[model samples]
Target: MLATRLIFVLSVVIGWTTACTPSDNSTSDIFIIGDDGPAPAETSGYFINHFGLLTTNLEVMKHFYGNVLGMRLMFEVHVTPEYSVTYMGHAQGGRNGTGFQTGTEMYREKNNLAGLLELVQFNVTDDSLVASTKRTNTFGHVGLIVPDIQETQDYLENHGIEILKRYGEPIQDFTGLIPNAFGLGEYAGAHIAAKKALMEAQGVIGIQLLLMVADPDGNLVEIQQQEQPAGAV
Candidate 1:
């Protein structure tokens, strides 16, 4: 009886704990939740399932993400009759990226892995709704996680991409939101993970306008290898 009672208590405690949860992002009441990121504490194995952009021309953006950026073309999925989900990218064989859906639009993986880009398109032919909307975050930026931050920065500058800097030093959130969200409550450990991820990110490619005061023009295009859990669909 004592053992059973102890187990029940443990379960109750765990239910109230953040660490054991499935990362449902319960605090999310708004769209574009962590755009002001070094993301929150729960970011591990999290790749953008989807992000929306506003543009007058889909072809122009596609040329960059698809042609110049080297994101693979997996398949085409319709978000709705009026919209589409263009699977512009994929990655992370182990660290799990997922898919996203909004209204009538839904996107998924070509395979079981994580980390893919889904560029939301309102109308392919006329390009009406998307053109009318301006999708830039208030900070006016794009973000990327490069494998070699220095190397990637150098390459971009050499190519005359005009690397912009908001901070004199590299930007990071050592105590990211993951720890906070999960209540792992390890400040030092979170910092180390943030540093490691920043150091190991590879080859971010694309054009981006930086936003926010923290890291301006940080990275709109990220080049990191992602991962997926075993048997993850």
Candidate 2:
């Protein structure tokens, strides 16, 4: 069913085309046929390397994702006196005996690790560079798979992390939160209702238990406990 839906969506996208004359160095109009465009030099072996978050406070974000969420600190680098980057992930092994490396060592073994979350921080005290509060209608959320949903919820609650949505909670109304694009804003209520129905159905099947919590920077983090396969350990 999922594959069928994906194929239908892809077919619709590929069948549609738009003609536009870009105001660049081009002299002719181009018809964009879905994802068709100039071929890249290397067209294969591509994957999502990592997700990066611009943080106001690196230490606070690190403590939230590391100590609270159990992601290991893979590496950290202080690029300059006012700038730093930190990588955290579920991958095992780090450097020295501290279970993390610094500097350029992480790039050497990048292929061996996956699911890294990069946190970048600029230590300048400029108010323009920092947001006073989190943007509520930004990117959706980062999802993490956990072994026990109830336990994860309890842990996050104990840590005083704000719980956006608990298990079996009704999907909140996001009428104006969604951007008014492609007529999506008008159907926000219907969309949320559909999502809530799907969630209830999935929960009845015991396939997944979900919890959504806010990180230190008010970013949403979805924690899910999925049913393991038979004899899986």
Candidate 3:
């Protein structure tokens, strides 16, 4: 029954382009896969619009992201006096690689989806709120790349956010050893144990970590720095 329904939908989607033609006398006809239509334009818009973090304290989350992280305050609106939404971003820009402007007020502008952070706060809560953390849950941390990691680290510390690890801190590399080791960058000649040791010694495995902070809701936030080449902004 499921397969029959799928075939009907597929036939409509592909404009009745099926591998086998349907017979007038047969009620059941098998569907064979066929080619799709022309591919859509490559310039279509597709990206993360905004990530929302629900919290109990609105002011704290706003301060941490807006004041401490230097994210421009896009705007703030109260769903009610007890509930509100705050939008923040690295810069004033539009979503989908359009309408980017530096030093513009977030509220004054619109459609800035490039790296927009949406923070939501509700004054009321019950026992229904499920607790989550990066360590214990599938939810991941937000990755931000700043020009100066150390400066951000200092700001976070001054605001009392814990520094989980220093930039370039080494961790055990457990990425399964690939067969074609030659093209695996630094892992070319290194075995599993050797790779682990080398990573331990160099203290650089994945991207450099500047700090890890928690929102008022205990959501982990990971911060990192961007490497700028000589004379490049």
Point out the worst 10-residue segment of candidate 1 by lDDT. 202-211
Q: Over the stretch 71-137, how does candidate 1's per-residue lDDT look in tens digits?
A: 5555566768867666655333212133332212222434444445556556645643311112222
| Highest lDDT model number | 2
What's model 1's TM-score? Answer: 0.37
Backbone collision tally, model 1? 35
> CA shift at 21, candidate 2, in angstroms?
33
- lDDT values, one for every candidate: 0.39, 0.59, 0.56
Instruction: Supply the TM-score for candidate 2.
Output: 0.58
Tell me the deviation in Å of residue 104 in model 2: 11
Candidate scoring better on lDDT of 1 and 3: 3
The sequence of per-residue lDDT tens digits that candidate 3 reaches over residues 50-124 is 888777777877787767766767777898987888888765432222344343545554463567888877778
Question: What's the TM-score of each model vs. the native?
Answer: 0.37, 0.58, 0.56
Model 3 stretches with alpha carbons more than 4 Å out: 1-43, 93-104, 128-135, 171-210, 228-233
CA-only RMSD, every prediction: 16.6, 10.8, 16.3
* Count of residue pairs whose backbone atoms collide, per candidate: 35, 0, 7
TM-score of 3: 0.56
* Superposed Cα RMSD, model 2: 10.8
